[model samples]
Target chain A: MSGTFYGLGVGPGDPELITLKAWRIISHAPVIAYPAANGNESLARKIAAPFIPEDVTELAIPVPMRREREPAQEAYDEAAKLIARHLDDGKDVAFLCEGDPLFYGSFAYLLDRLAGKHPTVIVPGITSITACAAQIGRPLAARNDILKVLPGTLDAERLKQEITGADAVAIMKVGQHFEKIRGVLTELGLAERATIIEKATREDERITRLADVPAGERPYFSTILIYQGSEAW
Target chain B: MSGTFYGLGVGPGDPELITLKAWRIISHAPVIAYPAANGNESLARKIAAPFIPEDVTELAIPVPMRREREPAQEAYDEAAKLIARHLDDGKDVAFLCEGDPLFYGSFAYLLDRLAGKHPTVIVPGITSITACAAQIGRPLAARNDILKVLPGTLDAERLKQEITGADAVAIMKVGQHFEKIRGVLTELGLAERATIIEKATREDERITRLADVPAGERPYFSTILIYQGSEAW
Candidate 1:
């Protein structure tokens, strides 16, 4: 029988946010596949440490994030080859991701290459947007409202248009684009309604109103939630 | 010491989808609260069976879905009373929800009443829309695209406006509203691009093109995913 590959979501920062399905799969899988930088430990693997069996094999795929295209593609290809080797040996492998595997997740890149060649199961987890919204006691969207999830890297004009048209917006991938996003929000009169969350749901999580946040403190993993209408409560 | 209350999201379906945080709270909480009707088993409680310990207390709040306003509010008042009783006794309670607790979840009604009186934590989960989308190998929305989540119970005109403005839409709470929603989709020229999923990620899950789904086979848990733009792939 061909070995199965499990794409498990470990959830946003909180270790206890991993799904029970993912926990079971992690416990039973003979090998665990994790993404990391070269010679660095896997964040997903470390978060899932509580439930993993001590004897499970670890397969580390170092996926470096680079501005250039060739290096990233080459890394994914190499990782796929390595995962295939374990499948050839008939060892079930579970690749762990921080949130939902397909929602702006890196696992999608690997799944695109490895799907159909092997049986795969994706276990979804709590996305950070929802967690962040809940942490701040606000609903992402309410009845008859529109929600838009935008990557902060988009051009300012496009981001402004999307934000203006949306009843609620969750801005993700906010690294170097923080200032641009802040500018767009301010231009659209959404500065007062927006809230920024850095490392949400983690013990060290910070929740601050957009107006109060300093430009220098923004992190890439952080998200900004903007609600133009009534408060959720 | 004051006790806490948790509105935990179990997940779309599949018992294993309960998050680690929810699992840990469910396992350790002195009292477990779940919605039920006429003494029937609670679906949320059933999904969380794997992690719930034998010794924990169970509080079944019968939250019947009734059209009568007085009865529904009464149920909420009574449920709050029971939960408050536990809190007064210094016992933390975990109230389980099928998907994310804040997304059209009845737990919100309870939270509105008890949130200030007691310590509460809302743990988010994977909503059915994402689960349905992932199961069908479809992206919820491409980069910078507009996405809307609307209840199928909305008037057709309102639904049409939201659908027309969105690059992608997930129409949820779709049971008897099937024909109405279908009509609106057809009128908006979105019928061809829609996919319907019922009981997503569950054992009896069904996914099909909207045009092919037979009438009278729809369930309330079903969701319709409509992609207004060309396929990203």
Candidate 2:
């Protein structure tokens, strides 16, 4: 019998956002897999720590983000090989992802490689956009409205066009692109309506209007939500 | 002291999808407010059952859907009055919503009325689109791709135009308009690329290729995900 591989979403920051199915899988799986940087603790593993059994074998696949495509591809290929070896040993493995595995998650790369060789199940979790919007006391979009969720990694012109066209927009990964995204929103006359959230749902969470944020202090995990309507107030 | 109003998203169906922040508010709030139909239990309240404390007060505000504007507006006014009465007592209240409170949620009606008078917090939960995509092992969109989340309530011709223009699209609230939305997808030559998910992530979850679903079995909770790119496969 082929061992099952579970791609579990641990949710955005808050540990309790994990689904019942994911919690159950983590507790019962004989082997647990988490992505980490070299010599770093896995964020997903830590979030799932309370549910993970002490007896389960823990495997950390170090996948460093690289500017070069070859290194990243090689890392994914190696991680798939490692996971395959564990599956061959007949141990059910649970791979922990911070949010929905299929939503900009690294697990997709591994799943593509392990297709048909193993049984896989994906457990969805609360996405960061919704979590951020919740903390700020704003609805993402109302009835008959359009919602566009995009990464801040896109170019400023494209981001501006997309933001201007959307009824509500959630720009994620607002790391270094903070100023660029802010400029785009400003150009589209949406800066005043935008809210910034950092480390949402966590104890250290901060919510502030985008116009109030100082330029030098923006964090990588921060997200900007723009509701392009006067009624948002 | 001013009483706080909580907009808690109960998630799609699974109780565990509710965030820890939402669970905390639901447990400690003096009153739990939910939308219902003539004293029926709210679906949001039921999904939140596992986390709601035994001592928490339950307040059901029946907001029936109506074809006419007068009845719907009247329902919103009545619901607002009930929530205001609880706030007058200086008691914290939690209003339960099934999905993200801001995403086509009826809570918007109450929020419009109650926000200025009370301190309101919105707790975001998992939306069905992400849940559906996860269950089917499909990506919502890739890097720099345009994703449009539309409602089936839109006219079929407009929906068809948007579907054709978007790299990926999620058609929501496919109730009486299932056939119309299906027709739009077909007209855009996207029938084979679309996937239908009903009651996603729930025990009753059903996923089918858009072209293969039986005509008579479509439900209100069903949503169609369409990705036009050939690379989606």
Candidate 3:
């Protein structure tokens, strides 16, 4: 009598950006799991709070956003086993993903363990790239233009190459690596066209051009979108 | 007393996928516009139909989907002027885009004409890439994996080169270009890993592996996602 394990995408920073399917699941799922950062209230759970009931049992997987996820694999592994136990008890477990569960989400780590054994569904959410683009009133790419969505976690050399070949580029996870990514965009002569967004769709969201952004540490949830608008498509 | 112009992203196929912001705008906008194929009911309009009142003034922007849009620039220009007219008359116009209005969306064309003159806001929606990934329960990319979103409108040579350089690829508008993109994936030894999704999140949604898809005409809403999972990130 095991129940389905659902991975819900709550979307980027906005509570209302969650899809109807995700909202339905969040409201009804008896057992829910969300990744928390160093014992902090989970961002995914926060975005889904409007839909989640007070009675649902919650499991918080401690996933550090400031550090590499490989080091946190053991924590996720244990979380999966605990979640599987709940599934075995016939209680549908909704594991909230920050964005699209498959898009750089921590839920992928859990899906590897739970998806095969239990019924699983991944509800897609609005990505930071698009949300940032909307906030900036800039098109990501159009008319045969190729958009390369890269991670700022990449080495500077690889980041430079990826930017050079892209018509449009959106870099995610630009926490402390903003300076490195900014350098690549500069080398490729795209720094002026780049827009950095922090906590997109949130009330306190910030949008600034690369050239205007002050030198400092950015929040963990940020995206850098660079458009080569002059390129002939 | 000119009115505000908004670019609303209705989301990938699901009607309920529309965000609360978009829903709020769509319900109250004096005029709404959406890209239509010839004289048919617009797909964007259909996704947003739930919010649009029967008496709301509708503007159908005829944008050909079966052919390249370069040849249809005049149509978009005309549509933009018509929308601007509504805004000039103190009417808030909500132009519906299928996905994120700024993420490879047709709204960009209208924004170029409207945003400079009238107040504009772009509401982000769930991208087809993420929605397709959700439908398949696969993440688009994770960690440092670079996701290349290429248009099927590209030349075969360019498409092959792009695919080779990408850790993950999602090709948009795979209508008649399915075979061409399939060939490129086969050349890159990624045909087996490629998944084709038609009308993702729709009632009659179809999901098939690139290799297993029968030789036929794919829908204009189709997407082909190729993942290079063997690479060590």
Candidate 4:
């Protein structure tokens, strides 16, 4: 009989943020896998390091750093094959995800490849959006407010249109596109209301006003949360 | 010196989904508070019941069941005053919230009242959005796809406009407005693509297609996740 495949979300950043369910599964899994971009240390693995069994077999899926899709698709394909071999040998494999597995997480790509052939389970984790909101001590959305999560990679015109209709907005992947997103928010007269949080719940977390961040100074692992706070809950 | 106030997110329905951080705080808290409508058992408290120390002082914040704003506002106001008493007596109070405290949670009401007067720390938890996605084994959003979270209470015209722009959508609070929201999704030609998840990660969790649910039948504690698999992510 084949072993089940588990997609475990370790959480946004803080080690203690890992769910009890995820911890319980990670402790007993026979084999484990995690994604490492360009051979860098996997954030998900690091978050789960304290709970993982010392002698468990570890697999690191090396995802390319390129912006193109083909290379990353090939990596997930190759990793799926390796995971399948373990599953075929009747050893359960747990794949660690930094956040919720299917919420823009790399595990989704792996799940798409492996789920059809094997029994799979996904344990959700704390997303960076809520983590950032918690750190800022502000409500992400309350009452009937519509919350929109936009990618910073979107063009300025599109970003403006989305933000215009949203009662609250969270812009993810604010690496190189930080300035463009900030400019759109500024043009929409929301610069004062927006807050940028980098590496939320992590040791090096930084929370700053959008207006305070200097131009061309792109921060990594950042999300911009825009809420007017004018509505009563 | 006054004790610190904490807003702890206990995660979605499943008790095991509680984070180690939240569990840790709940275990050691001198006093615990949770919202309950008309003295009903608090879902947050139920999710956190396992970790709470038996001898710990429990506070039930009685929230009235009303559509009007005045009564609910008064309830929160009174609860905040009572909670302040514990803090003033140098006893730490932990407020339990289901899902992330800031994400459409009632804890936001308490946070606003107590944060300014006391030392407040928010411990983020797994939101139902991600939990529902994990249960359904589907991606919430990937690549640059925009994800919009609309309240089912929104008017049909507004829901249609918002859904039209979003690549992925999660319609929350689908308690009584299921039929109206379903009508909107049908009009948008997204009825086949949407999946409704009720009480995700709980013992009685239910997953049903939007098209399968009968007309005029409203399911409680539900969320509708709509995504088109046409994008290669």
Q: DockQ (Cα-based) per candidate?
A: 0.40, 0.49, 0.63, 0.75
CAPRI verdict (incorrect, acceptable, medium, high) for model 4: medium
lDDT of 2 at B186: 80
| Residue lDDT tens for model 3, A70-99 | 546677778889999999999999999887
- What TM-score do all the candidates reach, one by one? 0.87, 0.89, 0.93, 0.97
lDDT of 4 by residue, B2-42 (tens): 89999998888898899999989999999999988887989
At residue A81, candidate 2 shows an lDDT of: 89
Interface RMSD of each: 3.4, 3.0, 2.3, 1.6
Error of 3 at A5 (Å): 1.7
Q: Tell how far residue A82 is off in model 1, in angstroms.
A: 2.2
lDDT of 2 at A229: 39
**How many angstroms is residue A212 displaced in model 4 relative to the true structure, after the best TM-score fit?**
0.7
**Count of backbone clashes, every candidate in sequence:** 4, 0, 1, 0
lDDT of each: 0.79, 0.79, 0.83, 0.89
Candidate 1: where is the Cα deviation over 4 Å?
Answer: A37-41, A66-72, A142-144, A165-167, A228-233, B37-41, B50-56, B64-78, B141-146, B154-168, B183-193, B226-233
Candidate 2 lDDT by residue in tens digits, A103-219: 666777787778668988877777888777667766787766778877777788778666765778888878878888888877777778898898887778888888888987656
Task: Give the best candidate by TM-score.
Answer: 4
Model 3 steric clash pairs: A102-B139
